[model samples]
Target: MEEESQIVFILFAGAFLAALMATFVVAMVILHRQRQVQNKQKMEQLQLEHERTLLNIENEIQQETMSHIGRELHDNIGQLLSLSKLYLGSSKPEKQAEGRELITKVISEVRGLSKTLNLDWVESISIREFAKQQLDRIQATGFCQTELDQEGDPWELEKNQKLVFIRVIQECLNNAIKHASPNHVSIQIIKNESGRKIIIKDDGKGFDTTIPSKGSGMTNLKKRMETIGGEFLIHSSLGNGTEIKLLLPN
Candidate 1:
């Protein structure tokens, strides 16, 4: 009976160990599942934040465009209309040629604005084509000469990614106009299996990279690229020029 009791104790110990091991495995599985759900939630949250940033940037660009339109109206088109009216009302016989010239100029300005300056609609276009149009607008100012080139197979990006790209390029163009005062701006898009790279170069009065500007928008530019899973790089000197590079992941 003592021997039988010893065998029973051994069996009990083995069963207890098996039960403990099973409990440990079940706990580990539950922990792993919880961690996976938490990770997925965090990823979703990050994507939402990035999307918000891109939308904000796009809104800012649209607002800036409206401001440009306002300036053109107040300074150029408005003034031209006023001058045309004054010329038309003149009773002096010698002012016929001048009046005709002013009227012609007014017609030309209206046609250009109606046919060309429309920049609001961008539903079906690719970002590359959109970028080309923006650079063309910059060049149309006559103060800047711009060139755009594309290489390799074009790729499509997510909507948020496209918006971020458009806004970033818009910002770069504005900065080159305002700060660098570049005479010639060159944009190139290079694509590969890995990803796409956009290079925007300007032959302008470049600034010293080491010196900090009070309110330069470089911070926003960097943040914009980071939100889109890309990279932004700038190279410039006091006299040489400025070159901006953006890289998108594969």
Candidate 2:
């Protein structure tokens, strides 16, 4: 009986030690996993901050260029056109007609360029307005019918997001026009519970993209969206249309 009891006690002690070691290993795994998650989050935040800094510098350079061009259009080229207009108005009928035509052409070009002169204009406008401009450009091409529709109330976005969003939309539009050759392109901005959704759909001659055939441009688009806390998705098949979606968290 004494020997049997000693044996039982030995087994019990061994079992308890095994159980303790198992618990410690589990705890260590959980702690390690938590640290990894925290590290990933910190890295993502740092990357976003870096992107914002680069984008700000880019915008500053673009703004400076716009200012210089604006002044040139308003002061130099604008003055030349005004003087020609006056000179033509005072000349004989034949010369006056020619000068009037020349002046009219200059006026039209200047008017068109003036719209592009506002340095801070792109960052100041709402997304809908920016989308309209892109659609209008597509419309001007006469290659496709462009339309934009909104769902839910408009959402406010920061300067960096706005810049990235506009560029991403432009990229999608360019891809649609260049590759898809679509007859119609539509954009929709819907505000949902998860976030804001921007859908770019085209009734173009889509191709097979099932094998992850997107080039660097598309990859860049994905990275940019991820940086802005948004997701990019693309769906397309042979002989069908292409659809691209951008989702931003609320």
Candidate 3:
């Protein structure tokens, strides 16, 4: 009887152990599935944020282009039209010829401006070319001297990525001009097997690095770079100059 009792107890213990083991396995599977769902959600959220950021950038670019067009129409085209009207009013053929020439120039400028009305320019222009154009515009301002240096062949970046870089670089230059009152601004592009680096340096009244920024510009820029698997680094100090480095992987 005791032997039978002992056998029955052993069987019950074994059954309980088996049940525990089964429960553990099921729990582990459920936990793994839960984690997978959480991870997937996180990834989808990141992707959505990235898309929104890109869209915002494109919109900002469009707005800037429109502002530029408005300025051109007011400052340049308006002046040219007024001058042409004056010349065309003249009785002399020479004045009329000059007026016609000015009209032709106005037409060409309009066509060029029309081309930039769309966002296609974002895809059409290379990073190097865009940088050069920005620098040229700055130099035209006569507020600061500008230079661009390329060490190696330009790397072909995705249109979206290139657009981000352009916006960021433009922002940096703008900040230097608007806030730093930089005397000289320089942009250097270096590409190699490892990666690409764009360094923007300015001789300006730099701010202290330890001081917190008054705006969200720096944070936004850092997030923008992180979204694209790149980095934005800034260095500055009072009485010294400012430098921004944009690093991108191959």
Candidate 4:
């Protein structure tokens, strides 16, 4: 009878051990599944965020383009139309001569505006030189003093990428002038194995980034950078200066 009891006890112990091991295996499987689900969720979230950023950027670009068109229409086209009307209505010889001169001036202005709006030459121009021209124009406006620096042999980047960089820099300059009230702005472009680097710094009053304003300009800039597989970093604090850095792969 004792021998029988010992055998039964051993059998029960073995069964218990088996059950314990099975439970452990099941638990590990559950944990692994949960981890996978969490990672998937994180990936989906990131994708959604990226899409939203892109949409915002496209909207901003459209808005900017429309704004430029409107300005040109109002300032150049409207003036020309007005002058043409004046010349047509005038009956006096002296007034007709004045109208003719005015028309000539309007024609010249239209030609200049056309040149400004043309994008055909962008492909032929170097980005560094283009940036320098932009800076010179901005300085001529007397809003702010701007400077540009470059390092390394400038690569021929995609046209859209070049335009995006130009727009982002222009946006930064505009922000510094209107909001930051900066006296000076500096831009630096560099190329390395990692990619193209753009740095825009301004000595102006900066705002808290944690409470970022949903400015169209900023949103568009972030979107453009993301679309190009680039990254942007903004460093600023209230009463301090602002620095924006962008990195784009070669």
Candidate 5:
């Protein structure tokens, strides 16, 4: 009878151990699946955030372009049209010829401006070309001198990445124009085996970096750079100039 009892006890113990092992395996599988789901959710969240940022950038660019177009229509195209009208009204052949020439020039300018109306141009334009365009605008302002220095070949970036880069550059230039009171602004783009770098510097009244900013512009710029897996850095001092550096990994 005792031997039978001992056998029964052993059987019970074995069953318990087996059940425990099974439970452990099940638990591990559940935990692994939960982790996978969490990782997937995280990835989706990041992707959504990236898309949102891109949309915001597109909207901002569109608004800026529209404002620019308004200025051109009022200040430039309007003047040309008025002049063309006066010339065309003249009885003299020379005046009429001048008016026709002006009209041709106006047509070309309108065509060029119309191209920027589509956001698709943003994706098609190269970063260097965009930089040159921005500098040209600044030079047109007559408030600041601009220069672009490049070394090595430019990197072929994804469309989204290009947009972020262009916006960041725009912000830097805008800041210089708005607050920095810089007489001269310069940009340097370098790409090689080490990495890619863009430096925007201005001879403006620099502020103390240690102090906090009242505006979100700087924070926004940093976030934009982070979205692209790039880095944004600023260097400045009082009475000195300010310099912004953007770095990208290979």
Candidate 6:
């Protein structure tokens, strides 16, 4: 009878151990599933945050572009139109005819500028080709003798990056024309160790870049460069020429 009792005890112990092992296995499975779920949630959250950041950056760039375009239209183009109208309303017939012709020319220019302001240009043109065209246009304006140089084989940049580059260059050109009155401008695009580099230099009357109150255009250019994970450095003085170096990472 004691032997039977011992056997019965052993059986019960074995059963208990089996049950415990089963429970451990079940707990491990549950924990693994929960970990996988948590990991997936974290990944999803990261992706969403990345997307939101991109959208915000894009919106900011768009706002800046529109603001600049609006200012150009309202301040420059609008003033020109108004002046032409004033001239048209003059009593002299010769003045009226001259005003009408000037109005026509101004309208044509506005249309051209408006077309450029559209984002379609960014989508349609290759960056290399676009850069070349812009350089030509700047030279045609007779504001400066512009030169473009490319070091490596041309590679297409991301859309937003291209736009940022174009706008920054445009701002620089405009500043050179308006403030520096440069006779010669040189633009160079070269492949650096990590990515791309742009250097724009002009033989013009430079300014004290140490002062923070230079202009909104320069500030805006810096911000645009930062947005694209780039760096901008300006070197200038009172009589010396100005040079701008912009670096963009791969």
Candidates in order have lDDT scores of 0.82, 0.82, 0.92, 0.78, 0.92, 0.79
Give the candidate order by descending TM-score: 3, 5, 1, 2, 4, 6
Name the lDDT value of residue 56 in candidate 2. 57
Candidate 5 ranges with C-alpha deviation above 4 Å? 1-5
Off by over 4 Å in 1: 87-120, 124-145, 153-158, 178-183, 203-219, 236-240
lDDT of 2 by residue, 20-41 (tens): 9999999999999999999999
Listed in order, each prediction's TM-score against the native is 0.72, 0.65, 0.97, 0.65, 0.94, 0.55
What TM-score would candidate 2 get against the native?
0.65
Off by over 4 Å in 4: 84-137, 155-170, 203-242, 248-250
Please report how far candidate 5 places residue 139 from its true position, in Å: 1.6
Model 4: weakest 10-residue lDDT segment is 53-62
Question: By the TM-score metric, which is better: model 2 or model 3?
Answer: 3
Give per-residue CA lDDT, model 1, range 1-250, as digits (tens): 9999999999999999999999999999999999999999999999888778866876776776677667777989898778777777889755666778877887887665554344444445687798888888887778788898999987687767777788888888878888887779989998988889999999889988888878848877888899978999999998888999999979
- Off by more than 4 A, model 2: 1-45, 52-119
C-alpha RMSD by candidate, in order: 4.4, 6.7, 0.9, 5.8, 1.5, 7.4
Q: Report residue 220 deviation for candidate 4 (angstroms).
A: 10
How do the residues 172-200 of candidate 6 rate in per-residue lDDT, one tens digit apiece?
77678778888888888888568988898
Residue lDDT tens for model 5, 1-250: 9999999999999999999999999999999999999999999999999899999998898898999899998999999999999999999999999999999999998998899896889878888999999999899879889999999997799888888998899899998999889889999999999788999999999999999999999999999999999999999999899999999888
Per-residue error (Å), model 2, residue 105: 9.0
lDDT of 4 by residue, 25-135 (tens): 999999999999999999899888766654554456566656766787797678877877787688888878877787787788677656545455556767788678767
